[model samples]
Target: MAPRIGVVTFPGTLDDQDAVRAIRLGGGEPVQLWHASADLKGVDAVILPGGFSYGDYLRAGAIAALSPVMTSVRAAAGKGLPVLGICNGFQVLCEARLLPGTLMRNEQQRFKCSVQELVVESIDTVWTCDFAPRQAIRIPAKHGEGNYVADAATLAAIEANNQVVFRYLHNPNGSEHDIAGVTNETGNVVGLMPHPEHAVEGLTGGSTDGLGFLSSVRRFLSVQV
Candidate 1:
């Protein structure tokens, strides 16, 4: 069977469908999961797509992080489930304490919409297994609060553990260390401020670089099996 990957839909999430399509294109079964549902439906992996969940009220993904489904997500993630959080989803992961670091507003105080260049800093995570270290890729990035910040201790820990997964090539939001993405210490949970789902197709996103992210998890699951 194809690896079933779940894409979560929160109240104001706008990118869930896109993530589903990307998962299908990457050779995984796409499962639509509602934010209110507690069961993950036996999905091998889960994706939290980009968008202003809960209308971005109370600080981006703060409210969405408390939804019913997230409770299950946290428990499953602790047991080694692979979870990928993109864009505003990154905020939710941080707020839920699944990952370290807080996503702040852009240093320029503006919403940015652009094709962003990023280098894969590490392939140790399940979500990035298909990528090579230091590999350059381009993907669509649209967000107002994509800048990543962390306390000095947290920064040092992630750096020491090679948890930094991706780094911005041009520093679009002035994130510390040019960090665009990170993974948990176990490498099963990952959060990034770019829309890999949007970049899975060349016709729409002008690049297919993001396919690797989805495919990597499928391959990871197969290897485990």
Candidate 2:
């Protein structure tokens, strides 16, 4: 059977459908997971898409991180389950302590949205194995908080372990080290500011480069089984 990928939808989530479409287009079954449900329904992987969950109340992704589904997500993630958190989802990952570093407001202190370029820096991660090292791809980035920061020690550790996955070519968000994405030590979880799901098809008005991210999950799942 094809891999069953779960796409979690919080109350304010806007990109869940796009994530589902990307999964189907990449040869996987899309499973709709909800915020209130703790059950993952046995999905092979999960995706936390971009959006202002819980109205971005009390900080972006702060409320959604405590949702029931995230409890299960955290547990599953500890077991090395593949999870990709995009944009606000990246904020949630940090808030949940799933991934290191915190996303703060953009350097300009304003919401930014545009098609952006990223250079893949780590190909060993579960969410990035499909891309070659230093390969560049264009994706959409829309967020008020996407700059990544961590303590000096933590940042050094992350760099030492090659946990940084993608870096913005032009540093649109002022992320540390030009970081656009990162992976956990196990490489099973990844978080990025770019909305790969939104860039799956040119008909939607941007490069179809994001399809590789979804396809990469399929390859990762196949290897796991």
Candidate 3:
């Protein structure tokens, strides 16, 4: 059977459908996982797409991180489940403590939207194995709070562990170390500020580069099986 990938939808999530389409295009069955449900439906992988969950109240992803489904997601992720968090989803991951660091408002203090270029810094993670080291790809990024920051010790640890997954070719949000994405030590979870799902179709997203991320997971699952 093909890998069943779950795309989570929070109350304010806007990109779940696009994520679902990207998963199907990447040769996986897309399962819509609701925020309030604790069950994951036995998905092989999970994706938290970009959007303003819970109206970005208190913090971008703070509220959604406490949702019932996230409890299950946290547990599953602990057992080496593959999870990819994009944009606000990235914020959610951090809020849920699945990944390290916190996303703060952009240095410019304004929302930015652009087709951003990023360098694949690490391909060792399940979400990034399809890309070659130092490969450049363009993906759409739209966010008001996307600057990633961590404590000095945490940052040092992340660098020492080579956890950085993607780096911005031209820094857009003043993220420390030009980091665009990162993975956990186990490399089973990844979080990025860019919306890869939007970049899967050239006609709509102006680039097909993002498809590599989705495709990489499917290939990983196939190998695992």
Candidate 4:
């Protein structure tokens, strides 16, 4: 059977459908998990797609961090269920403390929407194992608060542990160390500023590199058994 990966839907979320489509194309079953729902419905993995969750008030993902769905996501992730957060979803993971660091407003103080070049830095995580380390790929970056920041010690730790996932080739958002993505210590949870779902298909004038992200999860699931 295909892996069941849940796509979370919070109020104001814009890319849930895109995420669902991406998963299906990657040969995984997409399950819609509501923000208010208290359980994960036995999904093998969960993805937090990009959007202005909770309308971006009280910080990008502050309110959504406290959502009931995240409560289950937090628990599931702890038990090694893979979780991938993109853009606003990345913000939520930081707010939920699932990954280290905080997302701040872009250094340029403007919303950036573009196809971005990124180098996959580490393939140790469940969401990135299909990628070769340092492989360059194009993905979509669209957000005003995509800058990632962390304390000195925390930065040193995640770096030392080789958790940094992607780095922007041109450093679009001024993220610290040009970091575009990262993973948890256990390699199960990953968060990135770029929107991989938006780059799943070439017909949409998008890069297909992002398909690897979704397919990697499917590949990860296949290896588990």
Candidate 5:
């Protein structure tokens, strides 16, 4: 059987179904996971799709980071399960301490929407293994609080560790150092502001660059088995 990848849907998630479709298109079984459920359903990998989780009530992903499913996610990540967190999902990963740095409101204080160009900086992570280092790709980005921030020391550490995975070629938001995505220290978890899942299908009107991300996960699982 193909690898089963779980997509966690918190209340108010707008991209759960789309994420599932992306997963299926990438040749993996899409397992729907609920925020309230503590179980991971034995999936090989997990994805946290973008949306206004918990209505973005207290910050974008702050409330949702505490969901029951996140506990399992944290545990799974510790055990080296690949986790891809996109957009608002990226915010939750930082909030949950699964990844470093914080995503703040756009420096211009306006929500930005655009088809962005990104350079894949590292293909070492599970979510990006299918990509070649320094490959340029286009993906849609829609968010208000997508400006990534961290203290100078933390920022330096991330760079020193080569944790930055994707970088913006034409930066749409004022993310620090043009950081579009980053991997955790262990390289198993990755979070990015752009919506790669939205670009997986050509019918959606863009290059199918997002397939590399999902395909990377499948490749990772295949290697493990």
Candidate 6:
């Protein structure tokens, strides 16, 4: 059987369907996982797609982090199950304390939307193993609060562990150190403030750089088969 990948959907999630489509396009089975359920449904991997979970009422992803599903996500991550969080999902990861640091409002105090250039700094994770180090890819990013920030010591430790998976080429959001994406110490969990799922189809515009991310997951799952 093909690897079953889960795409979680919270009440305010906007990209779960797109994420599921991307997973199928990448040749993996997409399983729809609900926020209220703690079951992973035997998925081999999980993806938290971007959107204003809980209306971004308190803060982006703040309430979503406390969802019942997160308990399973946290446990699965601890066991080294592959997990990918995008944009608001990335915010939830930080808020859930699964990954390090936090995402704050853009320094310009405005939402930004555009195709972004990112240099792949590390390919050791399940989400980026298809790309070579230093390879550059363009993906669309749209968000109001996407600025990544961490204290100096945490930043240093992240760099030292080579956990910085992707860095923006031009620093669009004023993210500290131009950090666009990062992975956990074990490299199984990754979070990025971009919408790779939106870039997978040519009809959407731009190159298919986002395919590598989904393809990387396919490759990782293939290895298990």
Best by lDDT: 1
Q: Which residue pairs collide, candidate 4?
A: none
Which ten contiguous residues of candidate 1 have the minimum total lDDT? 216-225
Model 5 CA RMSD to the hidden true structure, in angstroms: 0.8
TM match of model 1 to true structure = 0.98
lDDT of 4 at 61: 97
Candidate 3 per-residue lDDT, tens place, 1-225, comes to 778999999989999999999988877899999999999999999999999999999999999999999999999999989999999899999999989899999999999999899999899999989999899999989999999999889999999998999999888899998889999999999999999998888788889998898778877888884
- Pairs with backbone N, CA or C atoms under 3 Å apart (clashes), candidate 5: none
Candidate 2, poorest ten consecutive residues by summed lDDT: 216-225
Which segments of model 1 are wrong by more than 4 Å?
A: none
Tens-digit lDDT string for candidate 5 (1-225): 799999999998999998999998889999999999999999999999999999889888999999999999999899999999999899999999999999998989999999999999998899998999899999999999999999999899999998999999977778999999999998999999999889988987467999999889988889785
lDDT of 3 at 86: 96
Assess each prediction's global lDDT (C-alpha) against the native.
0.93, 0.91, 0.93, 0.93, 0.93, 0.92
Q: Model 3 compared with the native: what TM-score?
A: 0.98
Alpha-carbon shift of residue 96 in model 4 (angstroms): 0.3
Q: TM-score for every candidate vs. truth? A: 0.98, 0.97, 0.98, 0.98, 0.98, 0.97
In model 2, the Cα lDDT at residue 188 comes to 91
125-185 per-residue lDDT for model 2 (tens digits) = 8888898889999999998899999999988999999999999989887889999988889
Query: What lDDT does model 2 reach?
Result: 0.91
Residue-pair clashes per prediction, in order, are 0, 0, 0, 0, 0, 0
Alpha-carbon runs more than 4 Å astray in model 4: none
Off by over 4 Å in 3: none
TM-score for predicted model 6 compared with the true structure: 0.97
Candidate 6, lDDT over the whole model:
0.92
In the range 7-30, model 1's lDDT, one tens digit per residue, is 999989999999988988999999
